[model samples]
Target: MNLMTLYDDVINEDCSMIVPETLNTPHLVLRYFRPEDAERVAELAGDIHIASGVLNIPHPYTIDDARDWIGQHRFLRDHGEEIIYAITVRESAILAGAISLRVNTEHAHAEMGYWIGRPYQGYGYATEAAGSMLELGFRGLSLHRIYARHLSWNTTSSGVLTRIGMVHEGVMRGHASKWGVFHDVHWYSIMDDEYYSSSVHADHPGRDPSGV
Candidate 1:
């Protein structure tokens, strides 16, 4: 479907906002979080290594935290503020991580963010999921720009952003403080025109060009 079709699907008779139910990638499925997934989410996200690499995750993440986070998804989506997907393996339906886009509807832009569990790292899952999100943001949501930020020391995340066709947008020195230490932040982004022109879209055969 084109943007208009996707846009209409995201709204119902009452005019409340909603996200596409699912987005598929070659080895993964992006879907909304379920209450049952909370335990696993806490298990994977509680790793100190996982929390240290990103700005927001608490090192001691718990199931309650996961539930709390998941609980906000619907309210946020209904307000046109965010979309968060549980990234799961297609074959086994196992939760690998989470990805999100915080949107600014009036500006037609969004910020992308994601993380893969330690056990699932280095398998290209994050990259695949991120590319699909870019498609949903630009093609499905008709967003003008999608940007992401990462800790400067996290070269792995920077590489994923680059592989997905995002341009390096510079860094904010001492911009983030996590666990009491200040860290610099690297920004990256891809515009609508840039995304359509990039090889990233053509490389993902599983992604439906018609939008999620």
Candidate 2:
């Protein structure tokens, strides 16, 4: 059976528990963050290069900031507002980055966001983790669409999205402000049908609870 048929078969079933606490891929383990991870999160995210590319991360990210952010994951996930995962190396369990889907359950859609630590940038961790999230969003959460946006100048991020089969929606001129400067942003999305039909979706690493 194809993914769309599988999606239809399981659409009305209770999928709240479908997503595992940890999603495993070839080289990474996407899991929930713990309090002890705060220091490492601060260390990695504090880099000026990491902060400048994203809108929300502050340049001098602190342990307290990381704690505050990690502390909210449970409440947000339990309430169906967001699902965030700490991207870790499979063998070492070293935290490499973070990824999330800010879900709008009422609309059956979500926005994807992520960042990899400076040390992990070139290894395709972002793409692997993102592909898992797409599976979680579309297959597990039953979302109609999943979209992501990045600063227009961040071509690397755009490449990741494209590599995962997200179509370029368009650019929003001066759509976001970071560090007091306005910047354009590029938007990309994949609908459920598009996701199920794509070859990339077939190869993405994740356990399909629905047996698609």
Candidate 3:
């Protein structure tokens, strides 16, 4: 079977709880968010530090809002073409953040985005989670290019992209607006060739390491 078919088999579980969690390295994990996650999600959603970088998440996010958000994720999880994964720590059931992938069939590529809670910042959760998502994009999804971007002023997100080894593709001036405030975004991408070459080198030491 193709990788997409296997990936489908993996997430098609009826209970969702039955889906085996993907262990991304050791510090962070990527998994489907459960409805029970609403309360915990509210804590992050309410923080301006966490929500500001995002275009839609408003400060003082309501519990009722979180309930609706969870319901939305559940619907997307079951029927949508895109995949969204929540980043959570293993020891604690608390959610640190979330990352998502949107495929562009026309371009034969996908784009990724993410956010982390304020308290969880600087611990490298975004970096770790992004690496896992990159692996999924290049390997599981078998896509040609995976891109990610963030507002130019959002240093935390820029750092996360750099940490994950994505090559910056420059900025989009006045790309979007939030709360009537215009924001520019920096774009970054990794191609299938880039990912494959890096993986081959990392897997084989004492080699040229440059895909020479």
Candidate 4:
């Protein structure tokens, strides 16, 4: 598990705006979405398995759906309410998946979530992207806490959360209704102090300077 920390210099004043045009990881690039990505986004996110694992994405994801979804990103970021990124492999620039952070202005915290395309599973891309998001939450955004919840059956999602140094808080029994039935959700979180004290965050070698 190679956990890369967000460089302190990347964050702008007060983190009212955390994302720049793009973020670089050792093997990935997290960047703002473009209209041209609609086709690939639709192809990757259209998997029934992928849609079933997340709360929001609908199955049979269409090109129009992808376009509409990417269209909302700019407005969300401009309002300081959310930060979403398109994940791509650094080597090939393949659209691997998507990740996001939903900010709670009143509480100074955010909910982080991500999904790796079916073809990209088992490559650690989701974990890598999520680690960057966590850095944005704790360091860039000056958030007190960052949390995420996954349906109980989604162990891969749980593993990604664990790999990022988030602690399992507990399970909310049947806390969410999805696909017309209730499901248990596992909650995990990391606080600012915990993020600073963690060896994972401390040993980060800083951002990649090669530029994405």
Which model scores highest in TM-score? 1
- Model 4: number of clashes? 0
Judged by whole-model lDDT over C-alpha atoms, candidate 2 comes out at 0.83
**Whole-structure CA lDDT of model 1:** 0.84
lDDT of 4 by residue, 25-92 (tens): 87789999899999999998899888999899998899999999999998888766789999988887
Model 4 quality (TM-score):
0.87
The TM-score measured for candidate 3 stands at 0.81
- Per-residue lDDT of 201 in model 4: 49
Backbone clash count for every predicted candidate, in the order shown: 0, 0, 0, 0
Better of 1 and 3 by TM-score: 1
Which ten-residue region of model 3 has the weakest summed lDDT?
A: 203-212
Each candidate's TM vs. the true structure?
Answer: 0.90, 0.87, 0.81, 0.87
Q: Which candidate is the best by lDDT?
A: 1
Between prediction 2 and prediction 3, the one with superior TM-score is 2
Better lDDT candidate (1, 4): 1
Give RMSD to native, each candidate: 5.1, 6.6, 7.4, 6.1
lDDT of 1 by residue, 66-139 (tens): 99999999888887788999999887788989999998876778999999998788778888999999989887
Give each model's whole-structure lDDT: 0.84, 0.83, 0.69, 0.82
Across residues 110-170, which tens digit of lDDT does each residue of candidate 2 receive?
A: 9999999987777778888999899888877778999999998899999889988899999
Better of 2 and 4 by lDDT: 2
